[model samples]
Each structure stands twice: as structure tokens, then as C-alpha cells.
Target: MLVNPHICPAETTVILHICPVEMLVNPPTALAEMSVSPLICPVKTSVSRLIALAEMSVTRHIWPVETLATRWSTVTPVQQRRSSTLAPVQQRRRSTLAPVQQRRRSTLAPVQQRHRSTFSPVQQRRRSALAPVHQRPCSTLAPVQQRC
Candidate 1:
């Protein structure tokens, strides 16, 4: 990959054309606080006409379709939007949470659900069955079961 010496003299560079913060901001800004300050990160790759892009910054930000889908994939959305101008300027919790979510599971969901085992009538079986496993069974397990 050809690195641009003009942008920054580094192999990887992040050009932060940050908007003037409307909200009072300090370091370590949380997602909740970001609602006031619409921080968007727009990426430009392989664009030949760099000069025109400056004038067209308004149109680029006016459409979030470019970065919305990508941001959705990574962040645990606080309140997901179908349409928004500043799509990249979302309240991102974390994009890396995807792996953690996948690692967790879809297992225990139906487990805790009320079990009206074929034996019982609908009303009578409203009670959840004796849990096959406790909530966070690993924590409760004896030392032997917890072995690495």
C-alpha cells in the first residue's frame, strides 16, 4: 500500500477533521455525552479529486448510509437509527463487542423460559422448570469443574 506523505508521514494515519464541539467536552468523553457533539469519522480512499472533496464536505456528512452499517456492526448501539445525517457520529459503545457477543451464546435463552412440559396444562406449567443449570453455573462450580 502506498502511504501518503502529505496526510501524515506514517504508514497508518487518522486525519481527524473534528467538528467544533457544541457540547462542553473534556477527555474520556462517554457515549452519552456525545449526543450533544456529533463526532463523525469520514474515510476517504482512492479519491483522485481531493480539492472538490473540501467543498462537498456538506453532502458527505448529510448522508450516513456510507458509515452507518459499519458503525452498527461494531458498536452496541444505544438507540439504533434507520436514518441519520451524521451516521458515523453515533454513540458507539464498542465495535469489538461483536466477538464477545458471538463468544457468549444463544444457549441459555430458552433454558430459563417457562416450561409447560407436555404433561401440564398451560396455566399450571407457568412456573419455570428446575433450572438445568444455574445462572452463571461456572461461578458456582466446584474447583474441579473450573480447571483450566
Candidate 2:
């Protein structure tokens, strides 16, 4: 447990029995208060010393935030390089696809118009076939089941 001497000077010597993992996961809200004051960790009271003690408590647990920050820093350059390499390829694909998409749209327009004109009769026929089944009395099922 990280105890800021400035915040709780009397209990500064008192060691907290909380697990570092628990502390990290649900960090004491007081840490935010301690962090608010930049001058809280002056030469007389060392924040590094408190942090070192906290680090010792959680020696087994990896400091995820720090680790991830470092990892992100390393990864950012690679990501930037990859994105830079991909930009031209993406632009080229977009350029090539634009004409193809326009051509497809033009072809599909007449087909869609033809389909709309021809589809009504087929749709009506289907609806008419289903209409009789839907309109049939439920009592007819018994006779059909008996025959089956």
C-alpha cells in the first residue's frame, strides 16, 4: 500500500495490510488527492520511496499501465509505418473500385427496373397460392391428418 506521508503524516509509519493487486485494481481514491499536489513529494518526503515500497509489495504483479505505456510507445512507430505503407494501397484500391462500382450501379439500375416490372405477377401468384392455405378453416386439418 502506498501511503503519502504528506496526506497522512501520523500513519506514515503504519504499514497497510492491503494486497498490491487489490490496491492497483481498486486504488485508494486518496492517491488521486495525493497526486493533485505536485509539491507533495518534496525533498524532505520522497514519493519515489513510497512508490518503491509499493513496488516491493507488488513485486510479483506486473505494473500493467506502465508496461502498456512502454509497449504502446514501441508499437506506435511500427503502426505509423504500417499505416503509411497502406495509405497508397488503400487509395489505389479506392480509385480502381470507383469505376467498377459506377459500372455496376449503371448495369444494376436497368435490371432492377426490369425486375420491379416483372416481379409483381410472380409475387401475386405466390400470394394467391398462400392465400387459400391461410384462409382454409382449421377444421380441415383434422380431415387431412385422417387421410394422411
Candidate 3:
């Protein structure tokens, strides 16, 4: 992740898919029901909380946070929105194509890269005549200023 305060990834700030340990300790109100965890993460930048949960065994009910929601879901993913001076929606950007080391792809992150129009395959080069060079930043631009 870019770790930029002004550019928090919206995906992480939203509800994380995790079930409560209560599911393991007691029978469900409905058989095979999975309970959703309360809001552990709020909508804000620079606020990251690492959470821990018990492993699921004896049943295939529990798995990684990401998988649990997809496999079994009784509650909709909570989506909360609040105004933040930082991390504006238009300013927020995400990219999964980076790891933390040499010849490193960190710069390839969307944090500094500008919006690119359709062009030839990325297999060629990131910069081309149609896409041109990305010299401007990612802030909202006026129509006249948006050329490139």
C-alpha cells in the first residue's frame, strides 16, 4: 500500500468481513448461521486496527476474513460514509500491483500515477502517443486542464 494519509484505500476503510467467536461457543439462532462482527474499523484515514479471531475447525464455517463473507453471509457488508478533510473520494486510488522491494513496483502504485486513457497493450510501454506521458497529478482537473 502507498501509506499516504491523503490517499487511504477505501476498501480497507470499509467493513472488514469477520465473524465473532460467539459462533463457535454457542448454537446459532438459525442453524449454520454466521454472525457478523461489529464495526471494528471506522471511516477515517491513518486509522488502522489489526484484529485477531479464532481459527475455525471441526466445521468449514470459518475461514479467512475475505472468504467468510463470500461463502456465508446473513448480513450485508456495512458501508459507512462520513466527511473527511483527507482521503477525498476523487483523490482515493488503489492498485494491487506492488510489493515492498527493489526494482520495486512501489512507484507503479496509483498514488502518483495519473488517469490513463485507452491505449495499446501495457505490454508495450506505460507511455505511448495516445496515452501520452503522465505529467499531471491525480487531483480533479477542469476540462481545459484535463488534456493528456
Q: Highest TM-score among the candidates is held by which one?
A: 2
lDDT of 1: 0.51
Q: Could you tell me the lDDT of residue 105 within candidate 3?
A: 59
Extract clashing residue pairs from model 1: 74-95
**For model 2, how does the per-residue alpha-carbon lDDT over 18-67 read when each residue is reduced to its tens digit?**
34445677676556756756556574368777788888878646676446
Regions of model 3 farther than 4 Å from truth: 1-57, 64-75, 79-148
- In candidate 1, clashing pairs total 1
lDDT tens digits, residue span 76-141, model 1: 354344435345444343556666686566555455453535436654445444344555578788
Write the number of the candidate with greater TM-score, choosing between 2 and 3.
2
Candidate 1 positional error at 29, Å: 62
- Tell me how far candidate 3 lies from the true structure as C-alpha RMSD in angstroms: 33.2
Among residues 3 or more apart in sequence or in different chains, the pairs in candidate 2 whose N, CA or C atoms overlap within 3 Å are: none
True-vs-predicted CA distance for residue 146, candidate 1, Å:
67
Shift in Å, residue 83, candidate 2? 2.4
